[model samples]
Target: MIKTWHLGDSRQSMVLASFDGRLPEVVYWGPALPDGESHQAIATASAADVSGGMVDRNAAVSLNPEASQTFPGHCGLSVRDKNGTPLAPAFRFQTETASEHCLTLVFADNALDLTLTFNLALEAKSSLFKLQSSLESADEIIVEWLAAPVLPVPAHADEMIEFSGRWCAEFLTRRVPFAPGARVRDNRTGRTDHAHFPGLIVCSQGTGNTSGEAYAFHYSWSGGHKMVAEELQDGRRHVQFGHASGSLPVGRTFRTAPLYATYSENGLNGAATRFQKHARNLVADGARSPRPVHYNCWEAVYFDHKLDELRSIASQAADLGAERFVLDDGWFGRRDDDTTSLGDWVIDLRKYPDGLTPLIEHVKSLGMEFGIWFEPEMINEDSDLYRSHPEWVLGPADQIRGRHQLVLDMSRQDVRSYLYEHIASVLKHHDVGYIKWDHNRVLPVVDASQTEGTYALIDRLRSDFPQVEIESCASGGGRIDFGILERTQRVWLSDSNDALERQRIQHDAALFLPACVTGSHVGPRKCHTSGRVLDIKLRSWTAAQRHMGFEMDPRELTEQEAATLRMVTGWWKANRDWMMQADILRLDSSDPAIIAEQQLAADGSRFVAFAAQMRPSDQVLPHPLRLTDLDPNAIYKITLINQDEAPALSRGAPLLKEHDLEVSGQYLMSHGLTLPWRFPETIWVLEGRRL
Candidate 1:
């Protein structure tokens, strides 16, 4: 028996399910119905011999030919029975419920009294589908492995791309040819570590940046996860992803994390655009009315806190057009450094004499919203909280700590309640507008059960304080996923704010996520992470491209630099609405040293492009940089912003002297203008408006 369902606005997506009297298998999933066809398209595709009848044992069986016979290539549900035997290829089709946008299919094994349900949902406006599964049983059963939405791809998808990275340097793309067998990317760290991101992109043999067919898969889970892309013996490829689970007794039910899959005929950028649209529509609180310009006090005064010094910094930030001022770490109890006082949520009287009231009031008076930082999920062994409740910490009794901190056993209700109350007390007592929530350490002991408790805490926080904004950070870029984004407003991209490094990080991170939800800040001239000094012009230009913010001390800036900061902030404030609402288009560049990105409004009225030179290329001469995603028929006036900072060229600087150049969008994209040669670490911004 088989069933086919049509999904999406244009009815272009088809999900084909076939049941061979045992379990239901998803045979084909992609694109929509062909012209003048209804269910025939799927019926014809699944008619092929999916069973292992024609597969020759001598050729099909690599090592053990009998292994492929009993356990077929595709199994909807993979489980072991009570007698330590794998379940046979048989299941009773129970029932199915369907709606315009969703379908729920159920199957059962009466002997084991176990039931499995697969839920599928299609986004109304795009070809993005979400898959999740749940298992329930009436009797006690030991479940070993469970995966949801095991989707099959065509055989032509021979190229694969996955991301891997370290702390300061993240999102390095790795492309390889998809050979036979399986390739798995696992994230066992309790939190999404900086090492490997949880996403995969598979393309056809000749796919390029903006052309060809591409498919992408990403998990919504922020905890330990595993993504497997396998090419079976029948020349079919499939992808399966879910939370990493261990054997456990299933008394009632277990649900797997949701996996999002999208396809694009227009290449990787087209697929990324679909994902960004889906995410923007599903944000918990919706997009912020107007994204705020933030000023963080971390790099300025790391562990040193003084009321007068903070007041001066806040005043300077407000003067530079910053809308929010955040007081970073070292403001909590006995927390002079990272070594102690992580769990203590109370204010440090020694640092602020009177509590946070003085600093908060002063910041509010300066016309900026006051924000504070907290690390509620971590605690130091020397802290008062850990000493009082030793059992609240995770791991062994004599466990090794990371960054001098132990993970709080969030799975324990008592631990969750204690941290919740303390964190809530701070929010309730103060007129705080934002919270920079930081998770500094990874879980040494992996516990899948703790994920639910972490979600509960965040859900409750959002429910209790609906007005407060939260920025999720796990040592930077660690806890970024749809699950966490549903509860938080923004995410910090990296701890290193060096402009040159950030260009690559933000460029790749924006592949799946939009720039509006990513937090990019300007650091000191001499970046603390890379120890590379960059000019303020380059740093400010790069930061202005995203949810703009400043992390350096305003007092350190000279008069000229301060004026530049003011100008950049003012420009962002004026154009942020369009910036946030535009679709990001990553232009194809032949030169590896140059990275180009564009933000074009949905209605094609305005566009902003940022071009940066990572290092000095061999070709010192200027070349034409063509733009993308513009209306070819419309005439646009291109103006080079912040060009006053450009050095005097031999021809008296064409970019600086030319206030504006009028050109047709067709000409600008095809026969583009040239950019002058500047020093390394130089960034240029071009703004185009349809006239």
Candidate 2:
């Protein structure tokens, strides 16, 4: 059985676990504030009048998952404290388990300001209290920053904090290093657990505070609690506030996955305990090799199917030295397009004709791993599950509405059990080596009877499927949190797969998650997602900078382009292990408009710099780029290769040209890679042993 320790309480401050844990086990959720940093401690709740009748007695509410649930707002005089903190849409805060976890919220009338403040908080958290404006290691703990990204990652492990389009969190684990697919064992629990958040976001909405308790006034998407009024013996009338997030609460579902939110801090603690959990997540070796850059046929293939067709593609892929072939969407039950039969897991005969067995065999015959995609968290309005149980939607029966598709109530045990069974069954059926688990819609509501409080649904999934290589997606980047990462290995960086756009996305993505996270670039002219025609090698090399892949038809590329991709594919396959773990050093773009750079460092050595000298101009602009975290005077050899056909140049691209570039504290070189006519670029190398 999964074990948990009981916590102890104390006086004053109501013991936000003042004396919890006989010792300790996991990262404690206290507050998300960074140490030595400060924010307006919410204008101080102690001074507010907090006086009134248990206000609205005739109020009604409900927790149904399908209805249009709304936290009714009232127009009343704004209450101001002695310090004059204006209270509009105030809420009372009191949790049955307040000592266990605290919620920190960022509310700005302006959405952009909310994002800006969030970014500031992220910067503060990254230093983990250090007063500098750079990235590195620190220990003010944070399992998942609420305001960060939905799919969060542990990048530097201690200090750096990452956010992907403000939906996912990424942890920087380099300082301590850990294996990618391993579990983190806690001193508290002899049992180890996986730690990485990746998944779809089911729900998120606004709330208001009406009560005056320190937590008395607050708001969230919750029902079942009634707004009540009462008269005390003092002959004064008072009101009771009802809401979600405390006794009132905020409900979230992570595709029925395990999402542990273990810490929070207001920045005043001697040390944030969540950092300890991060420390625990640290492993003996770094995460690398667990993720591979294989081709996934989803946008590339969609619904149109024929095993022979894919087999033909696979033959070329295998010949190109591709490691795996992922068959995405339309393979399961009658699903042939954006709108069609969903929630049915059986393979369609009209398409595959003969079940997936032959296709699996065909892929296997070509000596490549096989994978599949599934939108398990959602069901179409015309889906089998929806038709069978319309009541499964999350809001009140009469008022319920979905973002588009109906999401399964993973919050329910039966639903959890069923989905779990179906997923595992599919995996075993094909002995599938990989799964690109996709959840296209955000959750509208969760009404599972067996679950309670916070993180109920996610916790349950972690308990159920302990082994699965799931990849999280939400339309594009909606739900990405640390909780999902505990189970899935990677996440789609963003749905914007344009090569040029990917540079920023990749840079921004790596800021928070590990370098192994995948970002695909497949399309014609630009990309289907972006509409820019890019050099395949530029796309491939940029992707090499990440867990890259192509999302285009094999037939579109010229034999030359195909050959070019095959060559990079060769390099990627050979350096898969090295690429995944090397500390990345994103360089200034060779082409100010192009996303380009290099990566280096392994086994405690000086880092190597890889730059994509992409210039829109005709000549190579010889600008010396600052190589990140490098040691000065470390004898290193720089290698450069031509982008076009380099058969003769392949013996080793660098010629005996006198290029003793001088660098200051770190070696800086002015020697530039000659940009070729065909245009994909290759530059940099380690002089000797692994850094």
Candidate 3:
């Protein structure tokens, strides 16, 4: 017999589970019919004929069978018994409940004393639905594999899109054909590493940026995870995601992370918009506050920490209208470089004889909030913390270190207490308003308990120091996910601050997360990681679109460059209110060299658009770039923001100010304006207001 549960508003997204008088199997999960048609759809799908066709008798009841007798494509629960054999026990259907926005179903394997519960919930005012599963066993069970909310996609979804990248380069999109068999992507680095982000996009053939059926899934987990997209023997497809569960005992109940999934008949961009709306609802209250413009000292001073030099930089940052000042590394313990003193939280007397109080007070006196950096989850073996407590590290007797540091065994109660108290002590002593939390290395072993312990430490900090904001940085863009965003305010998108590289990185990262939660900063003329030189205007233009900040030394800027920085900073402050709350729209262009994005307010009163010419291309004279997400009938006044600044190259600027002096919203988005493409690496910033 099959039972169906639906959780949505006027339109429903249905979940179907089948039981052959014993175990319940999730058979169908996708978009449902409109209000009145849902019951008929479910009844037709759960009919006796459809129920009998799911079983395969050729390999049924065999020891090494390829599939279960009633395998639901993707198994919700797969485990081993006490005798080291796979358990295929029958589960009896239990009770189910439904609320206004949530539906939950439960099943029990009475013989093994294991119970499974699935929660299906819909976002308050969105088409998105979130699914998670939990398992509870009365006796100790050595679970081998388990996945919650296994999703079934239509067989027509032949195109698969996943993201893969390295440290400085993150979120590079990859597309492949969905063939028969399992295609698995795993992140075992104990972090949502730079290699593979915890998200996937599957679409049917001929899907463009804005116009075809698509399904997007993102796992809201920061630690080790695995995402699988497999095509079954039948014409159906399944997408599964969960934490990497190792050989751990199921003490009482183990719950899996939520896999956020959304379906859109309108295409990839439509699916992305739904995910963004859902995230806005879940964002913390502190994060929703206006993100301040910051100045970080990492690219400025590196390991050369001098009191007098930093004071001068602080004054310059204040002059440029920076609201927050951050002192990066080399202020704590014997940490002149990255090799030592990672676990030490005390201020190094050699760097500042009067401690961080003097520097913190100096920055605050300049009308800027003071923030510091910390890597509390790592320790160098040569440091005092590791020498005193050698057993606190996570690896073997002879541990192999990454980035000259070992992972602190956060699973230990003693380790948690030590980190919590020391980090809290710093916050209590100084007038610190923000923290740049850095995690530099991957875990030596994958353990879910350790991840939970880290979460506990962050929770304690938030409870104790509610006024302090934290920025999560795992090297760069490593620990980015909704799991960490729940505790912190923002994330450092990438280490490489090259303007050209950041255009792509920030563009893709903004698909699932709002621009306010992503941290983008302007680096020096020459980026440290890529060693590529970019014009200060190009860098500032790209950075201004997100949570804006400066990562370079202010004193190094020339008088002309300084004036441009000040102007850009002032513009961001005046317009950030609308920018933070605006809906992001990514535009499609025929030439890949031209990348355009728009930020339009929800009320359609104001909008900001950015277009960049990444590099020179063969198609020099491209077509007029059209805008999106604007009120077609409303009249709008458009102006060039940096018309007074010098042109990016020797070639002249586009005739934007001459030809398109004034226009209506419909004419602007439909007819569009042609931007100048004379110079390589050029950027155009346009501001629009409904008149």
Error of 1 at 617 (Å): 2.0
**Candidate 1: which stretches are off by over 4 Å?**
21-27, 47-89, 245-251, 284-287, 649-659
lDDT of 2 by residue, 546-638 (tens): 676666777677888888788877776677676565645444444553344445545535343444434443444334444433455554544
lDDT to native, each model = 0.77, 0.41, 0.78
Tens digits of per-residue lDDT, candidate 3, 456-559, equal: 99989999898998999999999988888888888899998998999999888767877777788989999899989999999998899888999998888999
Kindly indicate the candidate among 1 and 3 with the higher lDDT. Answer: 3
Candidate ordering by TM-score (highest first): 3, 1, 2
Candidates in order, TM-scores: namely: 0.93, 0.58, 0.94
The lDDT, on a scale of 0 to 1, for candidate 3 is 0.78
Lowest lDDT sum, 10 consecutive residues, model 1, at 58-67
For model 3, the superposed segments whose C-alpha errors exceed 4 Å read 10-12, 15-32, 46-74, 245-250, 644-655, 659-661
Worst 10 residues of 2 by lDDT: 185-194
Residue 202's lDDT within candidate 2 is 11
